[model samples]
Each structure stands twice: as structure tokens, then as C-alpha cells.
Target chain A: MRATTIHAPGDIRLSDVPDPALSAPTDAIVKVVAGAICGSDLWPYRGAKAITSGATVGHECVGVVEEIGGEVRDFRPGDFVIVPFVHCDNTCAHCRAGVQSACVNAGHTRSGQGEYAVVTQADGSLVKTRGVPHADLVPSLLTLTDVMATGWHAAVSAGVRPGSTAVVVGDGAVGLCAVIAAARMGAEKVVVLSRHEPRQQLARAFGATHVVADRGDAAISAVEEITDGIGADAVLECVGTAEALTTARRAARPGAIVGYVGAGHGVEMPVRPMFEKNVGLVGGMAPVRRYLPDLLDLVLEGAIDPGRVFDLTLPLDKVAEGYRAMHERRAIKVLLQP
Target chain B: MRATTIHAPGDIRLSDVPDPALSAPTDAIVKVVAGAICGSDLWPYRGAKAITSGATVGHECVGVVEEIGGEVRDFRPGDFVIVPFVHCDNTCAHCRAGVQSACVNAGHTRSGQGEYAVVTQADGSLVKTRGVPHADLVPSLLTLTDVMATGWHAAVSAGVRPGSTAVVVGDGAVGLCAVIAAARMGAEKVVVLSRHEPRQQLARAFGATHVVADRGDAAISAVEEITDGIGADAVLECVGTAEALTTARRAARPGAIVGYVGAGHGVEMPVRPMFEKNVGLVGGMAPVRRYLPDLLDLVLEGAIDPGRVFDLTLPLDKVAEGYRAMHERRAIKVLLQP
Candidate 1:
């Protein structure tokens, strides 16, 4: 089987690996049909985050169950499924409370960007489609594995309501998807902060009513100006940079919440401003598993086209080019066909 | 006129000061009927917070509007009113959103412990009762000015719901009041952390369903045991100390929110654990002005007895003793009559 592996900084390769096998009774062997590179993957490829020299990479995929363990009752061979980045039993206290990302018995899909991947907690983590749908819908279904679900989590956690104003910080795939989530949730105004022209245009196409090309303090000022100094009714922080978090917090109105889905690094939560303005900070590793069911339905019904985030695609063997394209900002996201 | 003044650390004095007068069109002269020593007062008195020598002290009081400025319309001479600790115009964007503490044109009542105090934003900051109430209801009305409303803010910010479990992480007047707030808000189980016997008894009397006397990590363990290791659905953080904040965050179940109201000192917000568990941190200085009307109605209707927190009383001249008693924990709270 060919799988994506990280060997060193700026080093991505499609290397031959052993085929995945079910290791537990709750596991299933998935033959990946489509997978996408994640923004988080850039952390290690850019040497910003330490990674094992030859570790499997990628956590977003749509696949067909090639085999299932004896105890996996809901899924079997030949079923098409969306694999959430994190696996959970779906019966833990956290999962029962709809916070599956914090499930006590959490697991991860092995070698997701590969020909075959082993999915643990199969019945609890995989959401099966009505059938292996047409090829045109696979990209949208693939996004539900991570990015699209994460974007929806941001909207829900920020408490986006009908007739409210929503501000999305960052213009990555997740941020663009968040624009769709906010619009779908009925926000009267959807403001996005993006300096990139291409991302901004896509954001507008996805439902952003306003776009700010400013950065840092300037971005905050722009958002404030757009909101008439009242600040956003809901703020979706899709980028985890300290500056982005600061902008998100400053963009919120008094009593409004900032729902952050990005993985934070070297970021200090702003306590004083958040306290004084009564702004709330919530959200984390999005419970994509919990949102997978509804999001899959939305994608199936053509209510949203989140797959548009994939601006480039390649054969699984050309995975290195996919990483390079995204690393250099030539592509918003790259889909790999296995 | 006699007003409570802070001379230095551990020093509280009732000093002769000039009689307060209407300083602005929105101001009114309040003839103090009741004023109480707050836990916050002890910060400066204990030297934890710096104070200007001879600065007027006390911010909680119920009084009669002895004189109204030219622009004052809703209040008039001899009208009984509850003066929120912080004054807000109540028409600013933040105020309209029910976060009066973040009001742009905020002010404070001048020397509330004195015989006559100047109230700014009078019409917006003072909630008038139907008439001069019976003496028995005065204490509860006084409480609405600060502690009771603050406790209610904690519960509201924590998103307390019917049948949910709530954990209060302080045992002071505010925390005890929070027990009542949580119960009134329909929490099925109200757990209070109180090591003091008297405060514990008071907490129980105020509708706390469970009392944990342990401190620090032990307290967290005790709460988990009480909730069968599931944690509280809502956590009210009435004390802003780092340890209290830590306990509050740790005691919340995944997806729970911790509403904090204490004036934080030397505290850092924990971002990692909060993000990991999807627990939200919110609340700050309580927006007491926004809650005055409804709380005043509850107090007037005898539906709540928040005044029970005031366990001691003294003549206005004995204001120093009132401070000493509260500082030494000899009294749960002290009420001074002027």
C-alpha cells in the first residue's frame, strides 16, 4: 500500500507501507477512495511541530470498508463511510454529551492518507452513506471527515443565531467552510477577514457578505468599523495564531462568544479583555464525529458544496506535489485519489 | 457627613467628609438607609489591592433619593432605590445587550457608606421599589445592589438549565447566593464548596443540595464523586483566585461552561485544558444593573431571602468594626445603618 509519510522538515513522500489490518474487534479496514491534506499537516512539514521521522500522516478521508472486525455491527465490507479524524466509542460520558473529541477511549485512524487504513471504534466513528454515491459527491463527503464538520462546530459553538452578525477570522479551508455554516445558520451578516484574493473570492462565493484584507490591529479595526463598533454577534476563530485569536476576541461584542477550532500553539488566551468585555471563549478539537451524520446528509442533499475548498487534486503516488502546492500557497487544499 | 475611608492596610475609618451634592444632571443625592461591607473591600484593607490614603470606601447600598438632578425623570425625592455598585447609562450598546458592566459611559456611586452619597446615572443605575418597603426587606434589597445580582450573573453566564447539575466554587456571600440562583434557575443538584461550618450551613439553607468541605484538588475529586465522575453541567466561579478558577474548570464536564465573577488577581487563564475539554470560560464583573429589576421583584415578592447573607449590623459610626468583622470572617457580611 502507498501511504503519505513525513521524513523531515519540508519532506513529504509517498512510501510503500504494509496494508492495514483490523487490530481490534471494533476496528475496520478501509480502502481510502479520497483524502485531503489538512492545514494542520503543514505544522510538521514546516518544521514548526516535531514529528516522528517516518510517521503516517493525514487524518481526513472518505473510504469503502474493505473488511470489518467481528464486533463492528453497523459497518461491513463494501459500505462507503466518512472517517472523522478522531475515533471515539460514542458511549463515553463526553461522547454522550456531544463532545466526542474528549472521549476517554479515543483513537485515531492509522495511515489515513494511504491505500488502506485501519479505523478503530468503527461503528462509533464511521458514518456510512446510503450507498457508494456518484464520484462527483466524494470530495464533499471527504470534507465531512474533518474540515467541514470543524467549520460547523465553530458556528454552533459561537452560538450563531438567525438575524445575528457573524465574523470569521482566517480564510483557510476551514474558515471558508465556516462562512457556509454561518450563512446556513441564518446570520444576517457574514464578515470574513482574509488578505488573500483567491480565498476572499471563494469566501464570498460561500456566503461572506463582507471581507477585510487587513491584518492584526488593522483587521480588528476593520471588523469593528463593519460592525458599527458594536462588534460581531458571533466570532469564528479558525486560525490558531496568537494574532488571529486576539483579533477574534476583539471582534466580539459584549456577551458574544468566540468559538475557536484551530489547534492553538504558543497562544495565550486573552484574559483581561475577555473578562472586561464579558466575551466568552469556547471550542477546541471539533467533535467532527458528532456532526458527521447531519453534515453528510447536507452534502448528500446538495445543500452545501464544501468540496470547492479542494483547488487541486492528484494521484495518490504524487502526494509530495500535493504537500508542496499547499505549503507554497498555490492550493487552498489538495485532494488525493487512492 | 461620615463616610468609610481607607487610611492604609488594615486601617478603616469613618471620617467626616463634605456632604454629597448633585454633580451632574444625571446625578442624585442618596440618603443612605443601608450599606454593607463587601468581600472586595477586604482586598484594599488586607493590602492585597492598593488604595489611595483617605479614599472613600463602600459601593453597595440602598437609599432614598433625597434630591434628583434636573434631568432625573424616573426617580424623585424620598423614593426608595437600590443603587448598583457600578453606574451605567443603560442605553449604550453593551448595556442594551444586557452587559451593563461594560457600558461605555460607566460611573460609580460616590461614598455609599456616608449619610448622603452622590449617585451618577441615577435613572439608569437605581432601581426604585414600589414604595418604601417594610424594614425586613431592606437587607435583601441592599443585596441586589451587588452580591445577589453578581451571584445571579454567575449562574446565568454558566448557562444553568433545569435538571442540570451546578457547582459553585466559593463559600462567601456571593457563592452562597449563587446556590440560591442555581436552584431558582432550576439546577437539579446545587453543590457548594465550603469549609467553614457557618458558611456551609448558610449555603445549605440557601438551597445547596451538596456541600464539599475539601480544598484544592480534593474538592475537585469530591465534586466528581458526587456527580459520579461526570462533572457539573454548570460551574459558578464566584472566587477569582487561581486555585478557585482551576477547581472550577476542572469540575466542569466536557462542554460545560464556567462563569467567573470574582475580581481576579495574579491569575492566568488556563487555555490548554479548557480547549482540550471544550469547556468555556466566561463572565467577569457582574452586570448587576441589568438584573436589578427582576431581582428587585423577587426580593419584593418574598420569593428569595438574599439578605440572610447579612448576619451582622452596626450603626453608621461603627463602620470600622463592620469592616473588621468581615475581614476576620467573624460575620458572613456586615450591614451598616446611616
Candidate 2:
């Protein structure tokens, strides 16, 4: 099957790779129906993250179960399911505590970035839909696999509630979805930091009450100004840079929770400031599996339209262009028909 | 008036400094009754944090209102009060949210280490006791000024609830107090990680259900073993270091909160493991004032005996010896009487 593979820095290609097959009794084959490029993918695509040549890419998808091992009892062939970025047994101590991203049995789950990918612990890793989803809803349902669920994780972790004011930093797909999630969760005023015109417009459509076209100190000043200098009741940090983290914390009221869901590297909390502010730094990898059930319901009921995050969609063969579009900020998130 | 002064590295002296008087309308003179050495004070003593030779030292104390500023309305002469380590206006955004340690109007609080020190923002920084605490309870009340309150901050920040299992790292006075605090807050099993025999005994006395005399990986293993490998529900990180932070997170169940109170100078979260664990890191300079009222009540009701933390007591002239005892590990905490 032809799948997205990275041959070198800035070189993503649709290469013919060996088809996936069930190697373990608990594994199942998922025929990728729809998938999306992730912000994290840009790490290696832009040469920021060292990637071995010929490595299969992608971690978000929705697909039909093509085959299942005997041990997989909950899902069967032709069943539509959401494949979360991180797979889990759903029974580990971590999973039971609603943090399946850290499941003890997570390492065994194979990545689901290609055609006919093998999913481990199929019963726990795949969330089967009640029925086949409509074609128009597939893109939105696919986000439950990672990005949309991640935004929900950010909002919930920050304790966003009705009547609360929130500020979301970053204008990527996840950040944009965070504005939607915060609004869905009932935040009265959702402020977003977006420098792009399209993102700002989408943010407003996603229920953003204010859009600050600034970054760093200026962005913080704008947020503070909007918040009457008291900062927001909740702050969502979708960007992982030090400056973004600082602004997020700076944009939060004392005792507010600043939820961050970026794959941050080499980031350190400025001890004195965060400590003195008494802010709670809560959030990491989204326990997407934990929130998949609720988020899927929201999409099915048309309560949220996360598919809008897919500003650009293309066939799986044009995966390289999809990566470039996202790299150049020409797309908030790219959807692919595999 | 005599006070402890750090002249240079390892150069602590009992220097005669001019007496403190109200310089601001919001300041009041506190007649120092008792003060204690802090783990953070060792930073400058070891030359890690340079100190000016003639600078007054110490931030913890309980004292009498020897003189009140014209604007002071909370107390009058002869009134006893608990002076928190950091002074605040108690009305700023941070202070209003119970983070007085980060108060915007906190530039005036003079350290209460000297015989007579000027307490800034007296109405907001001083927590007056209902009455003069008995002599036997003064030591316990003094801990409320910082250490004990700091421990309470750790437990509260970690969301310690009834039936929760908590692990406290570090055997310092603050850690011991955290054990007491966890138990006081109704943690079903409070575990203290300590290597010393006396400290272990103190931990148990302070209501620790178990004591693990190990550090680092071994300490985590012991904590996990005690919890049937499930890890504790909450972790109190009284020790501020990368190793301690890592162990605390490792010893916690996924989705658990780890509260830290040490003055962390240059610590950064080892991003990946922490992010993967999905743990929440909450803590900082304890909003000591926020918990002072409740802690003092517990001490007055004979519900907690924090005075036991001060194993050594000396006259003001022997302040240097007090610092020496704490630096040499001869005492968990040293109380200096003025």
C-alpha cells in the first residue's frame, strides 16, 4: 500500500510500503478511511525532530476494521472506529484514572498512519461508532482521534466552566478547536491569540469573543486589556514554546489553571513567577481516549463542527502537498482521504 | 537590636543593627518573639545565593505589636500576631486569590529576623491570634508563619481529599509538616520518604502511615510497592530538585497532583516523562498567609504540634550557631529567641 513516509528532511512522500498484518492475538487491521496531518509531524518534516528515513508518518485517523484477531471481541470487520493518537489497554491504572495517554501497555500499540495498519489491543484502542458515519461527518469524527480531543483536554484541564472567561494561545488547528471546546463547555468570553486573518475569522466562528492579533508581550497586553488587567479565569496553552507558556501563565488569573497540551521540549517553568502566581500547571498529552465518547456524541449531534479545522483536504497521494500547506500556514489542519 | 547577618559565604554574625520603626503608614513594628531557620536560607549560607554583608536575614516569625503605624487597624501594642514569610496588601489580584506571596504591593515587608522589625502592610500581612498564644504553643504558632503553612499549601494545592493516599518527599521540617498536613486533611495513608531514624519517628508522630528510607528510583519503588504498584493518589514535593520532582511524579498515580513548596532556583521539568504521565504539578512559595488562619486554629486547639519541628532553640546572640546546627544537619529546624 502507498503510505506517507519521510525520506529526508522536508521530504514527505507517498511510498509503497509493506501492508500491515495482525502479528499479535489482540491486534486488528484497520483500513485507513480518513486521516490528518498533525502539528507534531512538522517536527521531523521541518527537520526539527530527527526522523529515520523511510519512517511511516501520521497518528490520527478514522477507519473501518478490515480484520480482527480472535481476542478482539468488541469490534469486527467493517466496523467504523476512531483511532486515537495514543493507544491504550483502557484497563491499566493510568487508563482507569482517565489518563490513557500514559497507559502502561501503550508502547505495544502500533502507529496507525498507513493503509491497513495493525492496531494492538483492538478492544480497548478502537472506539466503534454506533453506525457508519456520513461522509460529511467523517472529517470531524476523525479529529476525535487526536486534535479535537486534545483541545477538549486543554479546556477541561483548565477547568473552563460557564460564566468563566478564557484565553487560548496559539492559532493552530488544536488552538482553534480549543476555542470551540471552551465555548462548548460554556465559557462566556473566549479570547484567542491569532495573527492570521483566516484563523481569526475561524476563531470568531468557533465562539471566540475576542481575537488578539499579537504575540509575546503585546499579545499578553492585549489579553490583559481585554480582561481588565485581571487576566482570564482559564488559560489554554496550545503552543509549547517558552514565550507562549509564559504568556499563557501571564494571561491567567491567580489560582486559575493553565492547561497546556503541546509536545514541549526543553521548556522550564520560570519558577518564581508561576509559583508566586499560585497557578496550577495542568495538561500534557491529551487523554484523548478518555474524552472520545463524549466528543463523538457532540459531533454526531452537530453540537461541534471540528471539521472546519480541516481548511484543506486532499487525496492521500497528495500527502506531501498537505504537509507543505500546513508548514506554510496555508492550512489550519489538513484532512486526507486515504 | 541584634539580628543575624550574612557577611559573606559562611560568615553569619550576631550583628547589632538599628531598631526597626514604622517607615510607612501601613507598617507596624513587630517585637520578634521567635524565628526559625529555613532550608532556603542555606542557599546564601553555602554561597549559592549571595547576600550583602549588612543585610538583615530571616523571613519567618511570630511577634508582638510593639508599635503600630497610624494606618494599622488590625492590632495595637501588646497584640500577638503571626507574620507570614512574605508580606502583601491582601487586596491585589494575586492576594485576593489567596496568593499573597505574589502580592503586587509587597515591596515593604521587612524580615522579622531582628529584635524589632517593621512589618509592612500590617493589616494584610499580620494574622493576629484571637489572644496571646500560650508560651508552650508559641513555637507551633511560629511555624504557621511559614513552614507549617507551606506544608498545608502543598497538600491543598495537590487537592488532598479524604481517603486520598499521599506521598511526601523530603524529611525537612516542611516535609514533616506535609505529612501531618496530609493526615490532617484526611489522607488515608500518608507516606514520608526519609533516611534518618529520628526524622522517621517524627514523621510517624506527625501521622505518617509509612516511612521509606530511600531516595530517587529506590524511593519511588518503595512507594509503589507500598501501594501495590498503583502509586499514591497525591504527592507533596517539599524538596525542590529535579530528582525529587521526578521521584514525586513517578510515585504518583496518573492524573495525580504533585505539590512542591521548595524555593526551586533552576529546576525544569524533564518534559517528556512528565507530559506522558499526564501529572499535574502545583506548588510554589506557599501562600503561607492564606493557610495561616486555619493552621493557627489547629495549633491552638492542640490538634497539631508543629513546634516539634524546632528541635533547637537559642538566644539571639547565638543566631549563628542556630544556622550552623541546621547547616550541619544537627537540627531539623532551629528557633531563635529575641
Candidate 3:
């Protein structure tokens, strides 16, 4: 099987690896159909976060169950399924509480950009579609495994409600997905902060009512101006950088919530200012497994086209190019066909 | 007029000062009927927070309107009112959004421990009772101006709901009141972290179902034992120290919120651990003005008696003694009669 691996900073390769097999009764073998690069994957590619040499990379995919362990009740071979970034035993207390990402018995998927992947907690983690749908729906279905659901989690964590003025502080795929989430949640206005022209246009098409191409103080000022100098009713922090988080906090109105979904890098939580402003911070890893069911329905019904975020696509052998495209900002997201 | 002033750390004194006068058209002069020393006041008393020598202190009081500025409405001479620590024009965006503490045009009341105090935004900050009630209700009414409302704010921010297992992380007046708030909000089990015997009894009386006396890691373990290792559904971080905040977060179940109200003293926000656990942090200065009406009715109707937090009483002339009692932990709180 060909799988993506990172040898070092700025070095991504598609290496031959042993074929995946069900290691436990709770596991399932998934033949990857479509996998997408995520913003978080860039951490290792850019050396912002360390990785062991030749570590299995990527964690987003839509695939067909090639085989399943005896204990797997809900899924079987030949079924089309979405594999969340993290696999969790859905019966755990955290999972029952809709925080599946924090499930006690959790395992992470790390070889989505491969010919085949072994997923643990198969019965609890995989969400099967009605059938292996048309090829055109594959990309959107793939996003539900991570980015789209993550965006929705941000909206839910921020308490985005009808008539809310929502501010999304990032323009990555997740941020763009968050714009759709906020809009779908009935936010009266969705304000997106993006400096790039392409992402800004996509954000607008995805339901951003206003786009502020400013950074730092100017960005906050722009959000204030759009919100009657009161800041936003709900803020989505999709970029985990300190500056992005700071902007997210400053963009929230008093009593408003900032739902953060980005994996933090060199980020320090601003406690004093948040305390003084009575602003609340919520959200961490999106409970993608928890949201998978609803989001799958939305995607299948054509309610959202989150797949548009995939600006580039390639064969699994070109996984290195995919990583480069995302790391260099040449592509919003790159979809890999196995 | 006699006012309490802090000459230095541990140096509290009753000093003669010019009578408070209406400084703005929205101001109203109040003759103090009851004032209580707060945990926050002890900050300057112990010198944790810098204070100007001889600066007037105290910000919790129930009083009678002595005089009103020409523009003052909803309050008049002879009316008994609860003066929130922070005054705000309720018409502002923040105020209207129920975050009066962050009102754009906000003012702090800093002379509650005085014979008379001037309150700004009279119409918005002063919640007038039907009439001056008997002395029995004075103490509880005074709490509505600060602690009681603050406790409620913590519970509200933490999203305390029916059937929730709530953990209150402090033994102070606000924390005890938070226990009451959690119970009132219908939490099935109210867990209070208090080592003091006196406070533990009071917490139980206020509706705490469990008391964890351990500190640091042990305290967190005890809470886990109580909640079957799942942690509380809601946590009230009423003590603003770093250790207390850490305990609050550790005692919370994944997806639970930690509503903090204690004035932070050298506290650093724990962003990484919080992110990993999906634990949320929210709350700040309580919006007493916004919660005053509902809480006032509860007091007047005998539904709650938050005044019980004041374990000691002192004459106005002995303001120094009140501060000492609170500072030395001889009293959970002290009520001053002017």
C-alpha cells in the first residue's frame, strides 16, 4: 500500500507500507476513496510541530469498508463510510455527552492518504452513507470526516443563533466551512477576516456577508465597525495562531462566546482581557463523530457544498505535491484519490 | 460623612470625608442602610492588588435614596434600592445584551462602606424594592448588589442545568452563594470544595450535596471519586487564583464550563490543558444590574437568603475590624451598619 509519510520539515513522500488489516474486533479495514489535507497537517510539514521520521500522516478520508472485525456491528464490507480524524468508543461518558473527541478509549487515524487504513472503534466511529454515492459527492463526504464538522462545532460552541452577528477569524478550509456553518445556523450576518483575495471570494460565496481583509488591530476595528462598535455576537477562531486567537477574542461582544477549533501553535490564551470583557472561550477538537450524522445528511442532500474547498486534487502517489500545495498556500485544500 | 479607606496593606481606617454629591444628572445619592465587606475588598486589604493610600473602598450595599439628580428616573428620594457595584446605562448595546458589567459608559461605585454614596446611572443601576423592608431582609438585599448576583453569574456562565452535577471551587461568600445558585438552577448534586468546617456547614445548608476538603491534585481526585471519575457537569471557579482555576478545570467533565468570578490575582490561563479536555472558561465581573430584578424578587419573597454568607457584623465605626476579620479569615464575610 502507498501511504503518505513525513521524513522531515518540508519533506513529504508517498512510501510503500504494509497493507492495513483489522487488528482487533473493534477495528475495520477501509480502502481509501478520497482523502483531503487539513490545515492541522501543515504543522509537521512546516516543522511548527515535531514528528518522528517517516511517521504516517493525514487524518481525513471517505472510504469503502474493505473488511470489519467480528465486534463491529454497524458497518460491514462494501459499505461507504466517513472516517473521522479521531476514533472513539461512542459509549464512553464523554462520547455520550456529545464530546466524542474526548472519549476515554480514543485512537487517532494517521494514514488517511493511503490505499488502505485500519480504523479502530469501527462500530462507534464510522458513519455510513445510504450507499456508495456518485463520484461527484465524494469530496463533500470527505470533508464531513473533519473540516466541515469542525466548522459546525465552532458555530455550536460559539452559540451561533438566529439573528447572531458571527465573526470567523481565519480563511483556511475550516474557516471557510465555518462561514457555511454560521450561515446555516441562521446567523444574520457572517463576517470573515481574510487577507487573501481568493479565500475572501470563496468565503463570500459560502455565506460571508462581510469580509475584512485586515490583520490585527485593523481587523478588530473592522469587525467592530460592522457590528455597531459592539463586536460580534459569536466569534469562530479557526486559526490557532496567537494573533488569530487574539483577534477572535477582541472581536467578540460582551457575553459573546469565541468557539476555537484550530490546533494551537505558540498560542497563549488571553485571560485578562477576556475576563475584563466578560467574554467566554469554548471549543477545542470538534466532535466530528458526534456531528457526522447530521453533516452527512446535509452533504448528501446538497444543503452544503463544502467540497468546493478542495482547489487541487491528485493521485495518492502525488501526496507530496498535495502537502506542498497546502503548506505553500497554493491550494486551499488538496484532495487525494487512492 | 464617614468612609472606609485603606491607608496601606492591612491598614484599614474610618476617615471623615466630604458627603457624596450628585456629580452627574444620572446620579443619585444613597444613605447606606447596609454594606458588606467582599472577598474582592480583601485584595487591597492584603495588598494583592495595588491601591492608592486613603482610597475609598467597598462596593456592596443596600440603601435609601437620599437625593436624586434632576435627570434621574425610576429612583427618587425615600426609595430603597440595591446599588450594583458597577453602574451602566441599560440602554447601551452591552447592557441591553445583559452584560451590564461591560456597558460602554460604565462607572464603578467605590464608597459603599460609607455613610452615604453617590450612584451613577441611577435608573439603570439601582433596582428599587417595593418599599424599604424590615431589617431582617437588609443583609440579603445587600448581597444582591454583589455576591449573590456574582454567584448567579458564575452558575449562568457555566450553563448549570437541571440534573447537572456542579462543583463550586471556593469557600468564600461568592462560592457559597454559587452553591445556592447551582441548587436554585436545579443541579442534582452541588459539590463544594471547602476545607473550613464552618464554611462546609454553611455550604451544606446552602444546598451542597458533597464537600471535598482536599486541595490541588487530591481535591481533583476526590471530585472524580464523587462523580464516578467523570467529573462535574458544571464547575464554578469562584476563587480567581491559578490553583483554584486549575482545580475547577480538572474537576469538570469534558464539554463542561468553568464559570469564574473571583478577581484574578497573578493567575495565568491554562489554554493547552483546557483545549485538550474541551473545558471552557467564562465569566468575569458579574452583571449585577442585569440580574437585580429577578434576584430582588427572590429576596423579597424569602426564596433565598444569600445574606447568611455574612458571618460577622460590625459597627460602621469599626470598619477596620470588619476588614481584619475578613482578611484574617475570622469571618466568611462581614456586614457593616452605617
Candidate 4:
């Protein structure tokens, strides 16, 4: 199978890797139909995070189940499904609490950026789609496996109530998706902090009511001005950078919640200031599995087109170019057809 | 009027100061019937936080209204009320959001450790008691003005639910009060991290089901072990130091909330670990005014006795000794009779 591998920093390539087979009754083999590069992938691609010489890259996808172990009860061979980013038993207390990302029997399968990927805990991790989605809708459906679900998690975690103002910090696919999530959650005003023209356009299309091209204090002031100096009721921190966290913190109103899905590499909170402002800092790894059902429904019903995040798509053989596009800020997200 | 003043660090003195007056149209003059020293006072008294020479201290008290400015219409002369530490106009957006501590028109009354103090935003800051609480209930009622309300805020902000495990970090008055708040909120188990015997006793008295007389990693490990290695669902951080914050962070279960009310002087969040664990950090300046109505009812109904935090009493003239006792850990809290 041709799988994407990152052999050292800035070295992404297509390599022939072993095809997966179900190793446990709780497992299934997924023939990956589509996958997407994640913001987290840039961590190693930019050498900000260290990875092994050859690590199977990517953690998002939708696929058709080629085979399933006998114990996998909810799924069967030839079922088109959404594979959540984390593998979990789902019956554990954590998973039962809707935090499957922290499931007790947690494990990870090889990256989905491959032709065939092994999926453990298949019954709990795979969400069966109504049918194989159209190829045009595949990219959008694929996002439910992670990105869209993650963005929805931010809104749900922040308690973005109807008629409230929601602010999103970041211009990436997830951030744009958050704008859509907040809107779907009935937010009256959706604000975004973006400087890039393409991201700004996507953000507006996704229901961002206000866009602040300014950074730092200017951005915060822009939000404050739009909110009548009150700040947003809910803030979504989509970027894992310190600056993004700062924007989320500063943009939140007193008693507001700042829900962040950022893999905070070096993020730190100024406790005193946040304390004084009474901003509730919440959100982490999205319980993507928990949100998948609702989000998949939204996607299928045309309530949201979060899949539009995939502005660029490439054949599995051209995975390198996909990463390069994201690296160069040319693509908001890239869907790789395997 | 005689008031407690911090001439310099470790130099508390009872000094003659001018009587408070109606500095603003929203002000009221109160003759303090009861006042309590707070853990925060130790910060300046112990030279941890700088204070200007002759700056008045204390912020917690219950008093009788002596005079009211023309604009203060809620109460006439001779109404007993709980004076929350921070004064805020109830009409601001923050106050409307139930975050009175961050009200736009915020101000502070004169320090409670005085014969008379001026109350600003009287209509919003003063919670008129059903009547003068019995002399025996005075100290407890005084706690509702700040400590108890602050503790309640921690439990409320953390979203303490029935059958959830709660952990209280810090052995101070606020921590003890948090134990009571958690119990009141129906937490299944309330744990306290404390090495002080008196505080441990008080914590248990306030409904702490378990006591772990350990600090740092050991304290976290003790909690983890108690919860079958899952950690507590809610953690109340009453101490503002780094160590306390670290313990609270490490002791929370995945997706748990750590509600902290400490005035974080030098606190920071270790974002990576907390993010990976999906812990939500919330809580701030305990919108005491918002919780006063409920807490006052609890106190009046013989439900919670948070006033037990005040273990020592001193006359107004002995203000110096009161500071010394708390600074030396000889007293948990001091009540000043003016």
C-alpha cells in the first residue's frame, strides 16, 4: 500500500507500507477512500514537533470497511464509514461521558493517509454513513472524522447559546469550521480574526459576521468594538499558538467561555488577567466521536458545508504537494483521494 | 474613625483615619457590625504584595446602613446588609451576565477593618439580610459577604454535579468553605489537600470526606489513587500559588473543571499537559454578589456555617495582633469588632 510517511522534518513522501489486517476481534480493516492533512501535521512538517524518521502521517479519513473481526458488532464488510481520529472502546467511563478521546482503552491505528489502515475498536470508532457519499461530497464527509467534529466540539464546549456572540481565533480550516459551528448553534454574531484574503472569504462564507484583519491589540479592539466593548460571549481558539490563545482570552467577555481545540504546544495562561476578567478557559481534544453523529446529520442535511474547508484535493500519490500547499498557505485544507 | 492600615510590609497598625463619607451619589455609610480578615490580607501583611504606606486593608464585612446618599434608594438608615468585597453597579453588562466583580462601574468601599466604611454602588453591592442575623450567626453571615460566596462561585463555576468527586486545593478559609460548597452541591466525595491539623479538622467539619495531608506530586498521587486513578471531576483551587495550581491541574480527571478563585499573583497554566488531558480551567473573582442571595438563605436556614473560618476574634484596637496571628499561622481567620 502506498502510505504517506514523514522521514525527518520537511521530508514527506509516498512509501509502500504493509497493508493492514484485523489483528483483534474488536478491529476492522478500512480501505481509505479519502483523508485530509491536519494542522497538527504541520507541527512535524515545520520541525516544531519532533517525529521519528518514518511515521505514518495524518489522522483524518472516511473509508469503506473491507473486513471486520468477528467481535466488531456495529460494522460489517463493505460499509462506508467515518473513522474518528481516536480509537476507543466507547464503553469505558470516559467514552460514556462523551470524552472518547480520553477513552480508557485508548489506542491509535496507523495514519489514514494510506490506501489501507487498520481500525481498532471498530464498533466504537466507526460511524456508518447512510451510503457512500458522492465524490464531491466525500471531502466534506471526510472532515466529520475530525475537523468538522472538532470545530463543533468547540461550540458545544463553549456553550455557544442562541443569540450570543461567538468569536473564532485562527483562519485555518478548523477555525472556519468553528464559524459555521457557532452559526449552527444559533450565535447571533460570529467574529473571526483573519488577515489572509482567501481565509477571510472562506470565513465570511462560513457565517463570520465580522473579520478583524488586525493582529494583537488591534484585533482585540476590533472585537471589543463590534461587541460594544463587551466582547464575545463565546470564543473559539482554533490555532495552537500563544498569540491565538491570547486573542481568544482577550476577545472573551467577562464570564465568557474560551473554548480552544489547539494542541497548545507552548501555550500559557496569564492567570491573574483571565481571573480578573472572569473568562472561562475550556476545550481541548474534541470528543470527535461524540459529536460525529450530530455533525454528520448536519452535513447530510445541508445545514453546514464544513467540507468546503478542503479547497484543494489531490490523488494519494500527490500527498507531498498537498502538504506543500498547506505549508505555503495556498490551501485551507487538502483532501487526498486514495 | 480608627482603621487598620498597612504602614509597610509586616507593619500593620491601628491608625486614626477620617470617617468615610458619601464620595459618590451611589455611596452609603455603614457602621461595621462584623468584619473578618481574609487570606488575601496576608499577601501584603507578609510582604508578598506591596502596599502603599497608610493604605487601609480588609474587604469582608457585614454592617448596618448608617447613612445613604440621595441616589442610593434600595435601603434607608438602619438596614443590615452583607457588603461584598468588590463594589459594582448592577446595570453593567458584566453584572447583567452575573459577573458583578467585573462590572464596568466598579469601585471599592473603605476597608472593613474600620469603625465606619463608605459603600459605593450601594444598591448593587449590598445584600440586605432578612434581618439582623442573630449575634451568634453574625460571623457566618459575614462570610457570605465574601469567603462563602467566593467558595460557592468555585463550585458553581466548576459545574459540580450530583455524584461527582470534588477536590479542594488549599487549607485556607476559602478551601474549607469550598468543602462545604461542594457538599452543598451534592458532590459524592469531597477531598481536601492539607497538612494543617486545624484546617483538616475544619475541612472535615465543613464536609470534606477525605483528607490527604500531602503536597505537590504526592497530593496529586493521593487523589489519583483515591479515585481509582481517574482523578476528581471538580477541583477548587483556593490558593493562588504555583504549587496549588499545579496540584489542582494534575488532580483533575479528563474533561474535569478546576474552578479557581485565588487572586493569582504568579500563576500560569502548563498548557500542554492540561490540553492533552482535556481539563477545563475556569473561575475567577467569584461574583460574590451573584451568589449572596442563595448563600445567605443557606446560612439563615441552618444549612452551612462558613463563619467557622473565623477562629479568632480581636477588638478594633488589636488589629496589629490580628495580622500577626494570621501571619504566624496562629489563627485561621480573625474577626474584628469595631
DockQ of each: 0.61, 0.63, 0.66, 0.85
B1-338 per-residue lDDT for model 2 (tens digits):
88778889788887888877678898888888887788888899998886887788888888888998889887899999888878888988788878788788784334556787778888988888877878999899888888899898889888898998999999999999999899999999999999988899999999999999988888888988988888889999998877888888899887888888877667777555667777888878887778888787788889999899989999878888888898899899999888
Choose 2 or 4, whichever is better by DockQ.
Answer: 4
> Candidate 3 — which residues are off by over 4 angstroms?
none
What's the best-to-worst order under TM-score? Answer: 3, 4, 1, 2
Evaluated against the true structure, the overall lDDT of model 4 is: 0.88
| CA RMSD of each candidate after superposition | 1.7, 1.9, 1.2, 1.3
Best by DockQ: 4
- Please give the lDDT score at residue A107 for candidate 2: 43
User: Per-residue lDDT for A38-91 in model 4, tens only?
Assistant: 988999999999889887888888889999999988888889999888888888
What's the distance in Å from true for residue A65, model 3?
Answer: 0.6
Model 3 RMSD, rounded to 1 decimal:
1.2
Off by over 4 Å in 4: none
Q: What is the TM-score of chain B in candidate 4?
A: 0.98
TM-score of 2: 0.96
lDDT per residue, candidate 3, B210-254, as tens digits?
998999989988988989999999999998888888899899999
Candidate 3 lDDT over residue span A4-23, tens digit each: 98899988899998888778
Q: Tell me, per candidate, how large a share of the native contacts it keeps.
A: 0.56, 0.69, 0.60, 0.85
CA error at residue A17 for candidate 4, angstroms: 1.9
| Model 4, residue B39: C-alpha shift (Å) | 0.3
- Candidate 3 docking classification: medium
